[model samples]
Target: MTERLTYYLLRGLFGLLARLPWVFVHGLCHVFAFLIGRIVGYRRAVIRANLSRSFPEKSLEELRQIERGFYLQFAYNFISTPKLLHQSPERITSEHFIMPDLTPLEEAAKSYDCVLLALGHYGNWELFSTGQLLLSTIGYSMDQVYRPLKNKALDRLFAEQRQRFGARLVAKDKIARHIVEYVRAQDGRHWLVAMITDQAPGIGHATYFTDFLHQPTAVLDGIERLGRKYHLPIFYFDIERRSPIQFVGRYVPLYDPKEGDLPNYTITERYARLMEANIQRDPAAWLWSHKRWKRPLEHYPNAVRSARLQALLDSAKDN
Candidate 1:
């Protein structure tokens, strides 16, 4: 009963907040940033550690600046995310979230039945859902893959907000099945699958270790495998925050098996490099509080690794 009441209270609070003007919400983000980053010091150690390790070449002062900026960006993403639930399609598709020249993606969709999107937890990633409505204008179906949250009520809330714009949410494990069904149905509609590829791979998931952000990082290889098997065209977004309430994005074609064959881990390596460049452009824009390197490379026995990555793993394991 208490948990249910808490969920309702949060739902109501978010609904009220969502109706507020962007300026007011922007102001609230400052307070939220201060409370979490300054007063409560929420995951300050983790954030600082992540920043320092990823940019070892930087001085203490530089890392500190990045750390502070990360907190503000994190706060903005969290507080403004719920606004998607109440905002109209016009409001969601406005200048606040710009997608400049989607010509490349559109042309690719014309040639293929499915396009895979590789996304990182950078910028206001939640706003990417606006693509369901925005891309639909061009006759494309959008689907996002998500791992279910532990809390049932919170998970339900997230589902409602995510699907509010017309995108279907598929369970991580069932995404392949969904894609297979979509393709076999021969509906003659273009489908876009968006996957957040930067997270540390979960247990039982295939992983590949590579030098990313100056460390041996583990990345999910599912995108590469699926794209190769199904000959799907893949793309990644280059997003830049224009203001506290706005972001401008460009879709860049990453890879397509239909073009030609590439070496093993080539697709994942390209994605890692692209994501690394994105984080370096605005260090604070990425999610620093996440324990990205928590799972040491040595944990996965079957993980694919290059010589340098393996050496790093061996050295860490010996220490």
Candidate 2:
């Protein structure tokens, strides 16, 4: 009962806050960023280090600018969540979201039972999911794989918000079987299994170190492996923020299941390249505060190829 009341109170507060002017909301974010960035010195330092590592060619001033922009964007993303939660589909679509070419993904979905839709924390990821929901309403069933949040209350609220557009949220732990089942059940109708490929996988998961933003970074291999195992088509969804209120969705074909066997790393590398390109185009739009490189130095070093990644690759080669 207490939890329910708290949830409703939070929702009410968000709805009320959403009524504020856009400029006011953004101004609040700027102030929040300034304070939070100062208090969280370690996070700011991490972002700076990451920016430096990713863009060594960039001048110190340029990197600092990127870091500052990242904090501001991060703050805005947080502040705008409530507004997004309360926004209706009509309003969201009418606002600033445009899908230039969704046909390729649709066509591939028709042929393949399951599709591995790779996206990143670029632009408004929430908007991308909403867009996916809208696409599904036209005739597609999207099963989104999401990492579980530690806070149960927040997680429930997030789940509700994500499902507002009809996309099913499949928790990460249950994703493999849920995806297989969903694909088999859908049988040819068209089902998209969306996975954010940019997150760093937990320790001991199958990961590969690739050249991302000019740095050796470890990335998850689940999407590619699952795509191969299920013979699913792979598509990369690039979210471009045209304005604070609008975004453009661009689809790029990554792999066709019918094509010959492609290495998982190859597919992941291709997706990574696309994400890098997007981040390069608009550095601040991507999620920069995430501890993307969280693995310990002894585990996954900043060197060209970390020992773990090297061993994994070597083992694969031997096999």
Best by lDDT: 1
* lDDT of all predictions: 0.83, 0.75
Question: Which tens-of-lDDT digit does each residue in 1-319 have in candidate 2?
Answer: 8777877887776677678877888788888878777666538767887788778899999987877777777777777767765677777776756776778876775576667789998877776667764676546778888987876667777788788777789887888897778667855566778889888777776346865775557777788888888788888988887765578887788888778876447887788788889999989788887888777434744334545446655675799
Candidate 1 global lDDT: 0.83
**By summed lDDT, which 10 consecutive residues of candidate 1 come out lowest?**
83-92
How big is the positional error of residue 270 in model 2, measured in Å on the Cα after superposition? 0.9
In TM-score terms, which candidate is top? 1
What are the candidates' C-alpha RMSDs?
2.6, 4.7
After superposing candidate 1 on the true structure, give the runs of residues whose Cα lies further than 4 Å from its correct spot. Answer: 300-302, 307-319
Local error of candidate 2 at 75, Å?
1.6
Checking candidate 1 for backbone clashes, the offending pairs are none
The list of candidate 2 runs beyond 4 A from truth reads: 1-6, 38-42, 186-188, 296-319
